[model samples]
Target: MNSTGVVLSAGDWRLVLDPHRGGMVRALTRRGQDILRPMPEGADAPFDSACFPLAPYANRIAGGRFTWEGQAHVLAPNAPGQKHPLHGTAWLGNWSVETGEADRATLLHHHAAGPDWNWAFTLRQHFRLTADGLEARLELTNTDDSAMPAGLGFHPWFTRRGVSAIAFTAKAVWLADAEMLPTVRATADTLGDWKQGAALERPDLVDHCYAGWTGQLRIERGDGDIVLEGEDTPYLHLYVPPGQDFFCAEPQSTMPDAVNREAPAPLLPGETRTVTMRIRSA
Candidate 1:
């Protein structure tokens, strides 16, 4: 069997993963209908996949610069035409399959200390398909002898064609500047209530992080509703590009430039942190 390409299936749910291509979920379907945007066959870019894991950190780190333990560290932009290092190295690094079965698979990635991060770490991602939905778990462990700042998240691209409404509760939302960095935080009352729900159609491009998220989101589509639940994720980054066929409802542990914000939790040597997400259709 090709370890690079693995599929997990349970009941009507099927999930395809590419461990060599940033360990991304190439496709996710329920009864042959895509629950997430399906990547074309042979696609190697993680950005084009149905979902991907974010580890060591999530989102961007302003200008690829951060100071940890009084030492300045710099990271080169991993994505083309972008100034900041995006997501994390886990999505761009090769992952080795540690175990697999008919309905579940686990992949592992180890990072050595480099100029970009300046610390070593190990990341593990597990994908499992249940009768009604999918569950994903990510764990990050600091392997270096010193403490390191870390964050975890999952970026999932959902089909936006028939999405009618989105509902979630957040205390505040971060407004970004032209460079996509947080400029100001607006309260829900001022920004508008997503808790009661809001129309998916919006006039402006939506790419911002909602702080103090309730870790629950509902997407109402023409065929059915997709419910997302996260464990220990306090932030949600919503990316809805106008005139696009896909949108992302990312469950994140921190906002963009989290390292500059000093928001990520510090992991001591040999310490591990984990995050889990569940997606269900109704």
Candidate 2:
């Protein structure tokens, strides 16, 4: 392993993580078959990796604007061409390896109070490979003196080849505007019977947040089924671009633009919140 990379293996599964590259899982494979989309060699962008952690908050904040506790804050877009603050800062920040073994590894990243969000916190990501699958845990603690709005999640990109169906349960879904910001909330049933599973290929692009999620999802492929289960995550974001090589089934603690909505949970000083994603193949 390199200075910034860690590998974990158990049974026929293997996971590669790079602490220097947003602490992302660069590759996930079972018996030499890609589960999540593998990162290209030398790829440094967090979005290019198989999976990355979302901390403090998840998804976009409209025009990078929000108000909390009587104070207004504006976050600059981290991406070159985006107008909104996409994802969170932790994914692009360097993390230090806290522990590593053949089957598990832990990484820690600390974000000091700054103009970006004006909050201090510590985030921990743990990855473990089991006999059947991989388990990931994200824990965030408020290190500041005042309470702060926070959310946690994981964005995993699964290879789209031969992906025939998807299954999940949710009560409502958010319709996005041209800029991909939430515009309206609609009953998920209108999107079809996703609970039983739905065809993967759709004529239109899908980039919406499903509210009241059951914290469970399954992606059916030609070889096997990939199941994702989350704890303490009430929202799931589905990003399936037309003709894309990969799709994302993200499990988040809150909805997109949560800082502007009522979804973000407040974390008091010294308090910690955790969200876990378990991945298994059937």
Candidate 3:
């Protein structure tokens, strides 16, 4: 499952994982039809992958800066042309295949204390093919001698070439400023009307983290419907870049810049946190 990754198959589903390229899913398909926007041949950037793991923390830390326990820390922005250190650091590092099989695989990434992030930890990503659909799990463990801040999530880009409707219920959405940092929490009434569902087609960029998620949602596609549900995940993040043929409905544990807002409770030494994402046909 390390890059020169493996393809997991079950029924009509097929999953391609590139563990070396930031533990990305190169492709995910059902009956040869793309489920998510697939990574094109020869492309190596994780940004182009079908999906990827977001760990240690979910989204950005304002200006790659935050103060935890009275100590200020700065993380270099990891994404291109972006000033914030978005999507955590795991997406920028390679993972080793800890275990691999025909239908499931677990990849491991160990992060050492550094300027980007202090506190060491291990993140294990497990991918399994099931009769219903695909199941992905992210398990993060605090290996540091002291406590560490941790969060889990996954960023999957669904194919948006045609009409794809989305639906999920949330109490509110965190509105951001020019830097994409949260500035306001507004009622879901004025948002995309997600409670009823809406097509993925839009004219401008839509990036925001929603609060009070119900832990489930559905993507309506022409060929079939994709239902995604998360276990113990309270927040949801959506990204829809204008004029792009791909869209993301991420399941995360914390808000985009939670460290800047209500910081996550520290993970005690030797403690582990896990989150599961399940995809099924509806």
TM-score for candidate 1: 0.96
Candidate 1, residue 138: Cα displacement in angstroms equals 0.2
Model 2 regions lying over 4 Å from their true place: none
Q: Number of backbone collisions per candidate, in order?
A: 0, 0, 0
**Clashing residue pairs found in predicted model 1:** none
lDDT on C-alpha atoms for all candidate structures: 0.87, 0.89, 0.86
When summed lDDT is taken over every stretch of 10 residues in candidate 1, the lowest stretch is: 188-197
Q: Which pairs clash inside model 3?
A: none
Query: What does candidate 3's lDDT look like per residue over 71-145, in tens digits?
Result: 888889888898888788888887888998999999899999888789889999999997678999999999999
Give lDDT for model 1: 0.87
TM-score of 2: 0.97
Model 2: pairs clashing at backbone N, Cα or C within 3 Å? none
Deviation of model 3 at 56, angstroms:
1.2
> Which segments of candidate 3 are over 4 A away from where they belong?
1-4
* lDDT for 39 (candidate 1): 91
| TM-score for each model | 0.96, 0.97, 0.96
